[model samples]
Target: MRDRSTGHPRNAWYALAASAEVGSTPLGTRALGTPVVLYRAGDGSVVALGDRDAHRPYPLSLGHVDGDTIVSGYSGFAYDRTGACVRVPSQAQVPYGARVPSYPVVEEGDLVWVWLGEPSLAALRPPVSTPWLTDAGWDTFGGAWETAAGIGLLHDNFADITHVAVVDPVISPPALTGVAPALEVELTETTVHFHRDWPAAPLPEWQAKISGASTTASYPQREEGAFLAPGLWADRWDVFIPADEGGTQTFRFTHAVTPVDDHRTRHLWRVSRNFAPGAEASDVLRPIFESYYLKVREILETMQQVIDRDGYGEDVNVAADLAALQVRKILRRLVADEG
Candidate 1:
């Protein structure tokens, strides 16, 4: 097992928040244990900087956003989007060391990503791309939420869906518990994909609603999920009712987990669907999908409690845990390489 103090990889782009979250006001949060402040500049581009003011230790996030700069409420220290301290209200000449660190940030996939490591590496890799998220034909809804579990554990939850049996039976039927899935694994340099099929599985209530199918009917469901290196997970779900070909619905679920600290993570989850696209998507299914994501959040919180008390490593591994195990191996390698 890796040390909690080891932290997450710094060279990767971590999703900080939804694009809309950083508007006129500065948003303050932690990513990979680093306090960061994000806001939009006068040109409508996202800017990221160290949240803490170097001089007074006040959070720059608490301050106000001036055109292209952040004006600290205390002492009136102002910093430009590049993290350069350009204004000192009391002094005529600003010292060279007065500037806060500027972080590289990019807005993509309807999310904002900030680089916490070597700035040069920011150009090497872009944020996790969810083309569906920004596509006009897909209905998208997402938000950020905090959870007690470390990012690794939260990601493990995504790599393995068998937990849905014991922890989230309501999302799907417990039949997946007794049945063993024939899993197909696809390995890559930076990501691991798992293809799973649940034959003749009864659709959950939420699935039924978005899929536009009868709740009682059984369907052949297929899911393809991938664990992206560093801290991202994406699952594409296809629910098909046997008789109705047009009734099949496709859902893309994406998760970006940023380790706030060793034991806490700020997570952004988005659900996109192609069945009902356009503006009407929100009016029709946003509420139901929002509730669905919240329910999973609650489940993860509960899982965190259990892990804190009893802990892992002692539990027996089953066939269902193969993908999760592989994810851990890949993550361990990524962490070691970073070190």
Candidate 2:
């Protein structure tokens, strides 16, 4: 198969899976079109390796994890965390060349990150970190789903929030679309930031709960959307709920898109809230949060399908597409720089 992953830079870290996904079993997945296997070492650190065995064609992911080694199911070949062939049952002595390719991996901020790039560059730039996921007094809920469109499309969608009208109209504040907030745009070497202030907007359930505002009232709000190099996007929305104590709640949404191939993308996402933290709050809100997240996932899947089915050439852009257009421009420039 053609490796479309070559179109993008390989000198950056990409999120492979959730931190909770890697455990006793070897998790089979792909990064930049390369087959990869993820597992935890004896010390609980995450390790990544090429899924294909050097001697045989069997995938190492199909094998089992035994302590610090992964045992091939077919020939009982054992490989260490470094992808070094430690034992070969079929032969008395393991050949020095019998080794699989090992990729640098790290677990940070509740996610597994693999560096599919130059070994030296891996240390210079780590994976995009979301501190709110683990910060004190913050509750996080996360889940991931694949899409048909490229990571660019997803990033564009986030940069432009107007889609909330059609995607999930019930939850999006009126100020998100009803009023045109002046956009403050900032561009750095490898990131773009946009901030907007809405003088009046209706608050959703989650926002209302923290703001202590009635559902029927419209309140002032602020939104900030940012995109990092490669494929990391973050959005922060704050609703100023009118309360006797004077309160405001901020919600953060993050997306890390890793290209699986030209037509497929693996998305790792999380939503963090500062208003509610710990089990007591989660016990009552988990179901509601999960329900909303599922809907958001569905919207992403639908967007990808629409893009793949219709193609970008057949679509048109409008005034609200300003942010998305900028994102596309940035991605195009970045991709060209990789070349």
Candidate 3:
């Protein structure tokens, strides 16, 4: 087992922010316990650099973006997209060590990911593919939350869906409780996949409304999800309705977890659906999804607080924790290897 108090793996691609959030101004954020500043360059490419100025140790995010350069507000020093200090108003020649660390960044779908690991490894393994977020056929909507918890807790929470029955009973189907659905788990070098299929499961009110079925209707529900890496988790939900009642509908839920530090995490969630691809549907569904996520965040943060105060006493696991345990093992290995 890895030391939970140590920290997260540094050799991973963490989703730093939504693409829309970083436009022309410098967006200050943290990843893997490092303060990072993100901004768009002249060509509209996302750039991630050390948030502080090398000269006076002031936050570069507080500065202004000038074309392809960022002019520091504290010392009037200008840094380029590559983090090279190009202009210093107080001196004629730039100092030899005036450059801040520039992280490799990639914009995929609706999110911008920053690699805080070895720069060479970034090109070899990029961020996971999330086509549903960018696909025209899917209607997508979500936002980010700064949770007061460890990233590992969020990972565990997402890996085990059985908690949905207790944590989000209102939005989740009732069938998730009082019965054991057939489950299958697969593990790869960098991912863990879980599948659950339940027959004749009651549909939630919101889903029934979209499918034009009775609120008491029952259908076959299938859930497939994967822990792609340290920073990404994706799951898909399919409810098989009758042909007269809108046939079948699919929903994809993505959770992007980035550790602000050992005790804080930034969780970004997005939901994309194949049915009702329009702004009206998004407006109707966004609030429900947001509320459920906020509830989960509250629970996880409370758990963190309790554990911090009382300590993790004799933690135990059951059969349902297989996937989460596998994730922890993989994360342990990854963090150990990096050491």
Candidate 4:
């Protein structure tokens, strides 16, 4: 586990918001405990800057956007895309040292990523690729949540799946309860992967309805995923239910976690499926996915409350925690290296 006092690592790219969510309006958000404002320039490119006005320390997101600049609502101080104070309404000359800090931003794969560290190091590492979110052959649906838990807990939740049977019985197979599947783990310098192949089991009602398979039918399932980086995790499911053409159905799940502060986190999730590839399919699955994540959020938030009231104790690990422990180890190393 990470030392709570060390705080979040600054030398990494975190997802600020979904591409579709950021537009002409200035968005106010917090990352790594610093307030940030995000908006699009004239060419539809993202710009991230310190959210506070340099003159009066007011929130810049409350201001309105000019053609390519953001004008402060409190004092009419206008700042350009570079975060330079280009215009002052009350005076002719723009005061020296009247500019806000600007951060590097990248828009890729339907997400806007921002670098919150030294400007020089932003070029050394880029955010992980998630091409499937925009691929033509797949349909995707997702939503964001303001979680009360820490980022580490969210990563741990994704790394271990045994909790699914207890927390989300509607989607998990009954056989998973009290039964551990053989897990294969692969580790890299910055990533950890886990794979598990479960024997033939009856399909849960929710999954059977989506896959067009009978609830009584049994199928082999393959679960695999990787911790791509501190900010992203990607996983997939391959259910060997016979398709009309004798193939299997695939579901891809991706999570982007960003820390808002020591006790709060931002979680963004995306679910993509190759079987359904249209707007109608996305509409049908959006609410179902939302419900699924809402339950997860409730449970995680409750855990956070308990941990806060009574301090965290020594952790005991079992066979099911192998991948989750690896996630914590890798994160601790990254945080230390940054320090």
> After TM-score superposition, what is the CA distance of residue 92 in candidate 3 from its true location, in Å?
1.7
lDDT winner, 1 or 4: 4
Cα lDDT computed for each candidate against the true fold: 0.79, 0.76, 0.89, 0.85
Ranked by TM-score from best down, the candidates are 3, 4, 1, 2
**What would the per-residue lDDT of candidate 4 be over residues 1-339, giving only the tens digit for each residue?**
323333577888899899998989999999989999999989889999999999897999999998889989999999998999999999999999789999999898998999998889988898899999999877888989899988877888899878887776776765475467878999997899999988888766765666567778677888898999888899998878675633687889999989998778999899998874578767877887787688888888887887787767567789878988888888778888987
State which candidate, 2 or 4, has the greater lDDT. 4
**Which segments of model 2 are wrong by more than 4 Å?**
1-6, 209-211, 242-246, 278-311
Q: In terms of TM-score, how similar is model 3 to the real structure?
A: 0.96
Per-residue lDDT tens digits for candidate 3, residues 1-339, read 323554688889999999999988999999888999999999999999999999887899999999999989999999998899999998899998789999999999999999999999999998998988999989899999899999989988988888888877778876687576656899899899999887777788887776566788778888888999899999988888887887788899999999999789999999998887789878988888898899999999998998788776656888778888899889988998999
In model 1, which range of ten residues has the least summed lDDT? Answer: 1-10
Poorest stretch of ten by lDDT in candidate 4: 1-10
lDDT of 2 by residue, 8-115 (tens): 667777888989999989999987789999998888888899998887898999999999999888878899988899998877899987888888887878888888
Q: After superposition, how far is residue 40 of candidate 4 from its true place, in Å?
A: 0.6
Model 4 TM-score (2 dp): 0.94
| Better TM-score candidate (2, 3) | 3
Q: Extract clashing residue pairs from model 3.
A: none
- Scored by lDDT, model 4 comes in at 0.85
Structural RMSD, model 1 = 2.8
**TM-score of every candidate relative to the true structure:** 0.89, 0.88, 0.96, 0.94
Off by over 4 Å in 4: 1-6, 242-246
**Error of model 3, residue 333, in angstroms:** 0.4
Model 4, backbone clash pairs (residues 3+ apart or across chains), number: 0
